[model samples]
Target: MLTNGLEKRTLSDVDVRDAFFDELYRLAVEDRNVIFMTADMGAFSLERFKRDFPKQYFNVGVAEQNMVSVAAGLALAGKKVFIYSIVPFVTLRCLEQIKIDLCGMNLPVTVVGIGAGVMYGGDGPTHHALHDIAVMRALPGMTIYNPSDALLTQASVRLAYEQAGPVYIRLEKGCLPVLYEDAGGGFQQGFTQLRAGKDISIMATGLMVHHAVTAKDILSRVGLSVGIFDIYRLKPLNEQALLEVMIHSPRVVSLEENSRIGGLGTALSELCADAGCRVPLMRMAWPDGHCREACGREEIHRHYRMDARSVAERILDWVRNT
Candidate 1:
């Protein structure tokens, strides 16, 4: 399939969604108290859980707001619950429920948002989850995990189970090349240094980490050594470590598919400001506008100059100009 002259990339051949649910399935098997609830989204991962543990599995039938409150109630009953739905609906539509029932009460419920950012391209702005991070992160006691690969995604399921308060997992639908051999080492720091460079550091979350990798390779050939920091944990990020790493580079760039208003860039900016550190920052994000593009994800990214070549050139321009 082609959209806007760019071949449509397969959304999730080796999907991280499966990895997340598979982990949940395993956990459910071991602990029947682990529950999986959804707002009518179906996947291969749901079959066994629904069949074997019917009581633990629920389909809320498109009622995302109700699902969140339901999840909170379940969590209050000493069950670790995960509420699933599309990125925007599960987060935006049920913002009140999540804010009050989950975060405000601080329950051990995982809000799994599928198709992070513009992955639901052609689904229109209504489906785009641009503000999930900003909104969820702002809520007190909300832990946000935006994993870039299947390994870390599975790890996030475990993290959600282990953590005490409300957790939000931002997931990408499509395939992300396996980046980590194992989910260990720097996993607890809430970020992973994918590659190290001195000239610039690209702080990216979710699948945008892959884009940062592409941009890193492009910049490498131009004699620019760029670091790629996969910031999986948006909230409760290891501030001292991230600040130290960001200062190592002359410039820091934040890349994400979400809206620029209060996403990754804003988080980094907050970190810098609170620390009284002064370093040039660039935010590569979806601009402030209603995105009406029906093109595929990559094509939409290309249109917004978020692809590798554009990001590389933009970085080079910034390096040259100031």
Candidate 2:
């Protein structure tokens, strides 16, 4: 939703890109050392940065690898740099640059990648960022953020700028409803419990958070008040706290748009193993493969049996038949 001063706006009114730049612009205003550079990606609020804060805006054409290297140099020069690009381009394409230039020195450069998961569902697998989380989490000292709403995106900007290491912010496009009333100090914990339930808990991140909340309501019709945990911060997850939440439920499901291999599911799985928790865990994520069929996210989700209905039905079967 479009934010006007402090007045609350509906969730549908804010675009992730616009909310991001809007918040970063505020930071740039206060700190002239803050800069934004991109690899010729989409221009949501870029024009504003160019027109009003020209000195802090940079457009590095289509050379993504070079852009990361440049941002590393800027960081070395005592500047807080943010490189905006599509998911694959910013991380996968320039993995070496990010690893050697930014991560090598633990620079304070924030890489903002748009189109989290299948946000560009119609754009085919080439645009899908199914492996982005796994790729990013592997970078040494890199912090990953997958925001579920505009409020978190704004908070993420501040957190990324304030932190000392390289940070990656994953975002989804389109009109997503607001999931947070306000992002306060607790955001630093890296996760939030949306609701509590006795039977099962759906630990979701990014856009799937909406599906989790909807699935919670859907399950309620069948007399199940499912728990919800939004794990926005992927890496450096608060494992002990998350385990505390999971131990209360008989089953826990890690929900996300990325692949189950090395995404949220895998992370949670590792946590359970290390903590010696025996609660049953299920992974709800994009199937490990590519789809050529051009479609919207909901349609693709339905085709893959990953929609809200599927999520509810699956949990229903687990709760009733298991």
Candidate 3:
């Protein structure tokens, strides 16, 4: 079993899933009303969850729709419900239930989707979650959290429990090097500036935040002053804070693993247009298409010019032109 002592270990080896479930199991122990529902996507930590909280845990087979409905029912019955499944299955397949049963009623149900973006890699388009943010964001009253590392993931789980309405926490599959020691007040503020610079600001979510940080280092070597912002909260975006940051930098680049349309890029663009912020913006994301088979996350990112080197080059080009 994972322990709180994990906080003392090297943060670079932390996995978001482990940190999330560890905190979840702790919460369940503290709150009898907490319940966990899964649509047949099993995890190593879940085995212990089932063994310890058998009465509160349910595996609804592969029925994503039923899983969501059941979670909504449990919430209405006074349970702090958490639903888990693969991203496309939980969000896209059960979008109707999520819309009507959860968001429509404004219940406190946390839907945790694993494998955000192309983390499914070889699983192809069916497993990719490029459109999850776009589709889910359209649903009214759904708060979205796309954490970049274990620290933020654990914090988001706690926030999910505290929130009253429907929340969607998107997570990438497998282990990832840690991005932050503490997301600090950033989780509450919706965004945090990881590195400060005057040339441009790179706003990124999920795995892209790590890439953007690396790109910042690369640009720094060439005397380019670039800033990095890690955005964990998508909806209910901190427009005032974002505007404050962007106002200092003349240019802003949004980097995300999802599609360029309707994800972070689109959200930020709309924020700029509506707020009438005059900062020139650029977005780096996957083109509207399916990732070919035999491609891993890095391969796909490289192909789309979203890798650190490529992103740095793109920023340089944009800076030169603009």
Q: How accurate is candidate 2 locally (lDDT)?
A: 0.87
lDDT tens digits by residue: candidate 3, 1-322:
2334256365557677888888899999999899999988888877899999998899889999999999999999999999999999999999999999999999999999999899988788999999999999999999999998877888888889999999999986566777666555637988888888898899999989989989999999888998899888998898999988888787999999898889999998898898888899998988888877568878877878888999999999888887
lDDT of 1 by residue, 49-163 (tens): 8898999999989899889998999899999999898988999899999999998898999999888888888998898888788888788898999999877887888888999
| Model 2's TM-score against the true structure | 0.96
Off-target runs (Cα >4 Å) in candidate 1 are 1-13
| TM-score: model 1 vs. ground truth | 0.94
If ranked by TM-score, best first, what sequence of candidates would result?
3, 2, 1
Model 3 scores a C-alpha lDDT of 0.88
Regions more than 4 Å wrong, model 2: 1-6
Question: Looking at model 1, how many pairs of residues clash?
Answer: 1
Per-candidate local distance difference test: 0.86, 0.87, 0.88
For all predictions, the C-alpha RMSD in Å is 5.7, 1.8, 1.9
Of 1 and 3, the candidate ranking higher by TM-score = 3
